[model samples]
Target chain A: MLQWRNSLARHATRQSVSVLFTSVGRRVELMRAFREAYETLGLDGKIVGVDIDPLAPALQVVDHPYIVPRLNSPEFIPTLVEICRQEKITLVFPLIDPDIPILAANRTILEETGARVVVISSNAVALTADKWLTNQFFERLGLPTPRSWLPAQCDPDEIDYPVFIKPRRGSAAKSTFRVSDPEELRFFSRYVPDPIIQEYLSGPEITNDVICDLEGEVLSVVSRQRIEVRWGEVAKGVTIYNPDIIDACVQIARALPAVGPITVQCMMKDDVPHFTEINARLGGGLPLGIAAGVDSPKWLLAKAAGIAVDIPPLGSYQRDLYLTRFDESFFLTKDDRAQMASRCL
Target chain B: MLQWRNSLARHATRQSVSVLFTSVGRRVELMRAFREAYETLGLDGKIVGVDIDPLAPALQVVDHPYIVPRLNSPEFIPTLVEICRQEKITLVFPLIDPDIPILAANRTILEETGARVVVISSNAVALTADKWLTNQFFERLGLPTPRSWLPAQCDPDEIDYPVFIKPRRGSAAKSTFRVSDPEELRFFSRYVPDPIIQEYLSGPEITNDVICDLEGEVLSVVSRQRIEVRWGEVAKGVTIYNPDIIDACVQIARALPAVGPITVQCMMKDDVPHFTEINARLGGGLPLGIAAGVDSPKWLLAKAAGIAVDIPPLGSYQRDLYLTRFDESFFLTKDDRAQMASRCL
Candidate 1:
């Protein structure tokens, strides 16, 4: 830990590197991690958090808090570009799924503000945003993904029982169901929009946080076995140094040519990792990887500061590090609400 | 408030009041609220948190943390009784729904250890535990609840197209689905265990935190409009001064004779509150109510210590107070885990 500080100091004097996290909803831990990284590196930086909701908890803690229009609104991109320019944001990170595609699609316009947007390529986003496309991408890479089929491709009479069905493009485990019978599958297929069915792998699920450099080079892969999940976020998890999972995540990062941080989810079937989906942004549980010493935020800040970051080889993070989470609140008074609203573009 | 501190001090002279929170999984805020109450009331107390899972996040902050057998284990009650006697516990509160029934059933044995177990009667638990029974109870009290029927009573041909089917006894929104057609309802009725069908209320949902005295008299009712929910817990909520909701909650409290704090969930339809289900214990979002000035923890501790708590009238809490939540983690080293394990009973 001390080595990085000395290395950064030796390479350059204290520099300013402001970060902008878009759609920063309830990501207080991630924002704090970046703040700590700046402090540890002795860099002058400001963490700016922007969300559509004025009551977002993360906005309460950041150095700069702004309320932006909804992602679908036309003003969303312009507001983000303006914030990046005003804050002198050196690094831009999109925190939510729906924000990724938009940011990636407009990456050039945002980069014009002199900020290095940490988003995957539009091609990678297209492959990841839809579960059906993700399955095809995984298969094309020769990775073992769950056998999936679109609604029209599935034969109700011939399909096996107890499969999983969800929307072709969804997040936060919404509208996902474990269909035990063909009748249920047929009903849910119609009920859920653009449904995709996949074989249910009744084994432990692992979430891999893959860190890549700005050049899209895979640096480290930290595998965490999800113990308990609440609302699609990991409530309890433990870091595991499984070579299979690590290698599979590295392969996925290389295939996607992912920039910054991306999360690859999979389920273990008889000790083999079967890919599920890839989130081309920081995972909700990325804090665990940082705690295990992968330190993606520190590395990202170091790279942005033009300081060489000494990232370890893959699967080098501390294993068996357990993480349990509980809800913490930020109480907003009338004045606080008004102050946040005033920052709206 | 200073009023409570003076009143508690006048009645009791720096008394010790130890609190035991059962199944204390991810209730770090609740535990901290009780700790703050004790400090404000000038009472000496130890907060004891027990969970079946050793990695429970709340355990990391309590004054005494212990691991116990599962609620179904025959040794569960015996272990709890032993801990209460050992720690000289003054008040007991169960944090989860399943734990409520077990603790209510074993209230006599637990209270025999000179601790007042803050649980409602077994009848109340039975009425609240089963969704079907809860609907019946609400209707019997002349309260407006969503029209509901057990799977056996529902005729597929006569039922409405859009409705909800969930397990007859379930919590945390598990296995709950909105059926849009007869085929979907028929499939889900068989899919969900002991399914009950209810009219799907289309309006916004509201959760009321009702605080009652030891004698089962309602003191305060705090209603919060659920702006957003994640995993059945309120993520973004705003306190609302809905008189109809307040009166309905007070009526439900009087009918059930709630002993301590209970949560009443409902959805508004055409501006009328239609009751859903009642949880016969403190709500997960009770912290918002406390912050809004209900202060149930302080009231409970004051009552337990024989102090006259100056609780205002029903619906007295500050309205329009917003609450937003984010996950916070507790990191346990290997040594911390071993220390917690050694305290297991």
Candidate 2:
């Protein structure tokens, strides 16, 4: 039965193109979007998904899911290349921000294995990896950005209370804090690794997903006001149609020369967006944007097929639609885990 | 400014009816529903809400909010009654399940203070509180229920694997366990408080919000398939039009002699609903039922005013309208806390 299924999977991929998702942990919605766009276009496509954990829910939904070594492991890239060659993967992409920089650096190596990596330039990835550098880059481009200072640059006596202390390069808000006094600031600076103190910006946070083509031209931008966050990830978001945020996103993408989908995070203060972090990949809540009529997966698929991108002049999308998430568990026995784990090699 | 606000609050309640919400921790949506319904009815109804914590988000939204003593404290009932009389609160209700039985037992004591309590008889609350009794009662009444076994009665050698071990009287799925072996069952039985063994019913969990009049006649029952749960609470729920589940909810409400709004929990296995729980109060997901056109708050409001409820003959409601919940926040100051705390006295 296993051999028959593998033969069927190979037959299906032979008739169409294949896309790969790396470190695709619990990104079932993104995988579904690509599958849907492929089915709509009358193409039988297979998604080659990879995650370190065999229990990753995203792996369950894809055709060829592999359990590879951690991204930092020496064997990781080599194993990924072998899989790409074996699966005939045409387009390789990483959904996570941390994974983007690594993938971008190994773009040439991955391309040599017949699967071209779909990521922004390493230059843009480096700037985004560090929040402090991102603020400077955004400031130079005349974009609204949060005022930031390294921990070493702060003067205790004149420093403002109620400021944010965060890592210089962080994702998912790991080791982040809000300090109200000098004591807290001093404590968190030592507590958090590579602490970067930032001016407190209060109000609603908004995320904008900007799709740019290979030519570095913005195709469309969809912004949503993140109403709630659970465990430092967006839990509830509402699609918003704001011309100013959209314009800012387009300008930022052009300045950074980001290709494919690059999502920018901003917080609204005094009715103006202050760019906080830029992710050179799809946002966690990109499905909400897609549900609101933003066809991101379709654009990415077209690019992977080496087809020219075409985004219509009118980029209108549904607004005020709320996206709320909840947990769903998939049970796998011990034997199933063992089999999937070995399949990565 | 405090004195002026107090004077205005007294004036507002003096002109219209008042509703007291006890243990109103974070029920902002329920409070909003009442506020909107009151506004539409043109009755300047003031919500007098009380919680042990002054930082309760629900308190921040109401006109009269308080920090009361713990429910188990001797001062709780007296303090609640005094506030009801002083605030001229004509209706008193508790949202928390544990608080319901205590309030139900003190129903007449609360009524003596000219504030009618919105709760069923102590008998109904007692049956609903114990899962074992609930199943036996449902089974006796010809309603489908999961076969249950007392922990002491279960033999490890002969008991079925994949049984559920849960607290006989628990809320929010606290200390619930799904054991697939004898060792697992034995271990969980020791860990769980007041453990009761139940036959595992696999399928989708459906929650039905049933609103019955003061006479225990169910006016409407809105059932929904709980698509997902977050932290053991319904987060992503879609309205389900299951005639069997709806009919079962109505019959269960009548059998229990439950009044006002009672929510029923069931598992749909092979097209038949196995009743798991019968709560004699509105559920956490009642807003979904209301959004699906149940109008529970409206029905309860009419009962509070000693007015007869007129549920339409057809009870036709919007079907398949999805209700998604997200976290929202409320900020309060030190002074705001002090004033609301004092108002409870």
**TM, chain A, every candidate:** 0.95, 0.92
Off by over 4 Å in 2: A1-345, B1-15, B306-310, B333-343
Per-candidate DockQ vs. reference: 0.70, 0.03
lDDT agreement with native, every candidate? 0.88, 0.78
Instruction: Please report, as a residue range, the 10-residue window in candidate 2 chain A with the lowest summed lDDT.
Output: A325-334
> lDDT, candidate 2, residue A205?
93
> For candidate 2 chain B, which ten residues in a row score worst on lDDT?
B325-334
lDDT per residue, candidate 2, A93-164, as tens digits? Answer: 788877898888888889998776778889988898999999999899888887788878997568777899
Model 1 over residues B106-219: C-alpha lDDT tens digits?
999999999998889998899899998899888888888899988888888898768988888899888888888777877788888899999999869999988887788888
Q: What is the TM-score of chain B alone in each candidate?
A: 0.95, 0.91
Error of 2 at A318 (Å): 36
Kindly provide the TM-score of model 2 when superposed on the true structure, using C-alpha atoms. Answer: 0.54
For all predictions, the C-alpha RMSD in Å is 3.5, 16.4
